[model samples]
Every structure is written in structure tokens, then in C-alpha cells.
Target: MTNTAPSLVLPEISSARLTGLLEFLQSAEQLKDTLRSGTTANGRPESTAEHSWRLALMVVLFEPELKDIDLLKLLKLALVHDLGEAISGDVPAPLQTPGDNRQERERRDFLTLCEPLPADIAEELLSLWDEYAAAVTAEARIAKAFDKLETMLQHVLMPRQEASFYAFNLGYGVDRTDCSPLTRQIRDKVDGLTRALMEDAGRESA
Candidate 1:
């Protein structure tokens, strides 16, 4: 557990209510230590918190281009899209098998993680998560695309991983990214990089 607590600026509220909010936020801090399958440039495992941070950053950076969408809602979707992973950890797309019930498991975990928050706040977060999970709304769809792109971006930009790692990304998450022109453009570039990495990894092995 991270010993350092964040300096939160909360509005004036009842001590009990404030304590509940603080406890929920504190539990959420565990995401900083929850490792994902990807690694940093230095080869350290990336945490779920880092992934969501970048995902939200992606939304902010692309805000001008995404004027048609609800930027705030989209950002929220991105931030919470993988909040479930903070509880159950992440399952890399390539390793996920059919019938794994990963979504179901993650949904349950998300509910548990949100238990400390007020009922309305928790329900709203869950609804956003579910929207992202289902990719039913336009904002949700874009969030999913950004999420996939961010994962692939990290993989390609990181130091040369195994040949299979590069190979796995070639066909990974196409369906999600293909939904938007901006995302598709980004995906194409990432795919090109992935292919280059694949070729390089193959040559080094040969």
C-alpha cells in the first residue's frame, strides 16, 4: 500500500461523509500498485493507474478533434474504463480466452471497489463503467478506441519485446479502433510500428 496520501481538496461536509469519501479515494490508491501486462520503457511493469492516466490524457489531447462528443463524460469513461482492473488486475487482450468471464469478474470487482463511495456516486461511476464496457454510446466507443490505442502505443514504444508480443498487436483491438476516423489513423500508425518491431524481432532471432 502507498503510504503517502494525496492532498485532496474537498468541500465542507460532515466529518462522517468526508471520511467515507476519503476512505473510498484511499482504497482507489491501490491502483497505483496494481500491475498491468505492459511495461514501462525501463521494463518495469506498468500500473493500472498509469494506464488510466494516459488514457485520460489522450482524451484531453484530442479534445479539439472530439468536439462533437461530451469531452467531460468521455474523460470520465476513460478514467473508469479500467478501474475494475485495479481490483482484479488486468488481463492482456492476447491472453484473454473465450468464456473467461473477464468482464463479469471485473464488473463485480468494480462494484466492490466503489462500495465506499456514496450510493449515487457509486452508481454513476458504475453506469459509466458499464457504458464503456458495452461501448454502446458514442463517448463510450471512443473511450474504448483510446484505451486500445494507448495499450498498443505503449507496447510499440517500449523497448523491443518478444516477437510474439509484436505479433499479437497486429490484429489486436482493430474492431474497437475502426469505429472512428481519428482512432483508425492512430491505429494505422501504431500497426506500422508494431510490424516494424515484429520484423526486427524476427531478424534478431534469426
Candidate 2:
């Protein structure tokens, strides 16, 4: 009783948690190096961080087009949308379909990474991630849609390479119109734009 509950030792707890978060976030950044077999405009492999960062800009572009959307929330969601990839790696759309892989798996991995975070922050971010995957709200839907658009945009920007065309032409399409109106509008524009890009790439290669 001489030292007032032995100083409570909370600092160590907090410091350890912080150290873990920093470690995980740094690891998250390296995920950008785990390429998706998708090339950039210059035909270079894309890192996970680069993919997420570019998608953020695409989300920014949709702010004006969204119907009663939360721009700031969407931006944050886009920023962390793929943070789980640090653990799961970049599991692109073709392989990550409805059943084989889902949000639950990603959420589990994200939760593990944030275990050091104050429970509230960890839970909240996880919830935001779930919301992003669900595409239930306007902000989340648009953020999620921008995620898809970014993949296509990468195809548009990619150099004349087989991977570039594969990204643009192979196994990519949108089914639901209601999930995102702005995204639907953008998709229409992307179809022709990506096609032309592919043609240009083909010409250059030829």
C-alpha cells in the first residue's frame, strides 16, 4: 500500500498495444509489394498500398455524384478497406467470390491485428470494414464501388501488357444497379475507355 496500487502499470499495457499497432501497420504497408498479377500504367506490379491509395482518389471523385453520402467516412473507409490484406494478401475479385472467401474471413484477420487496440477502436474499425464490404449505406456502398472501379482504372492506366488487358477484359462485370448509382454511371464510361486503352496497348505491343 506504500506506492498507491503499485502505479497501476497501465502505461506498459498501452505502450505494448501501440507497439503492436505500429508493427502491424508497417507490415500493412509492405503488402503493397504482394502484386495481384495486375500491372500499373507503366506495366509495373502494384503493391497493396498503391491499390488502396489510388482507390481513395476515385472515392474523392464520387463525392459530388453520391446521393446524400458521407464523404469523409467514405474516404476513411477507402483508406483502410484493404488493411486486412496485410494478413490475407490481395485476394482479387476473380478468386474472392461469393462463397469461397468472404468478409467474415477478412474481418477475423483484421480483428486479430487490432487486438492490441483499445477494444472500442478495434471494434469500430472492424464494423466500418464490415459496412464497407456490405455496401449497405451510401458512403460504404460508394466506397466499396470505388474499390471495384479502382481495379478497372488500373486496367485503363496499365501499359500495353497481357496483364493489363486481362484486368480490363477478363472476368469483370457489375450486376446490381442499386448498390451504387454513381458507380453504374462510371462503369458505362469505363467500358469504352478501357477498351480503347486495351487497343492502344495492343497497338504498342504489335
**Which model scores highest in TM-score?**
1
- The window of 10 residues in a row where model 1 has the poorest summed lDDT is 10-19
Please estimate how well model 1 matches the true structure, expressed as its whole-model Cα lDDT: 0.89
lDDT of 1 at 156: 76
- Superposed model 1: Cα runs more than 4 Å off: 1-11
TM-score of 1: 0.91
Estimated TM-score per prediction? 0.91, 0.76
Q: Give the TM-score of candidate 2.
A: 0.76
Instruction: Quote the positional error of residue 75 for candidate 1 in Å.
Output: 0.8
| lDDT of each residue in 1-206, candidate 2, tens digit only | 36665555544456766776687677666566667757777777888788888888776665667657777888889887777767777776656566765576767777776776666767778878888877778777677667776777677776655536544453375653336556677787777787776676677778
Q: Candidate 2: misplaced stretches above 4 Å?
A: 1-21, 161-171, 176-178, 198-206
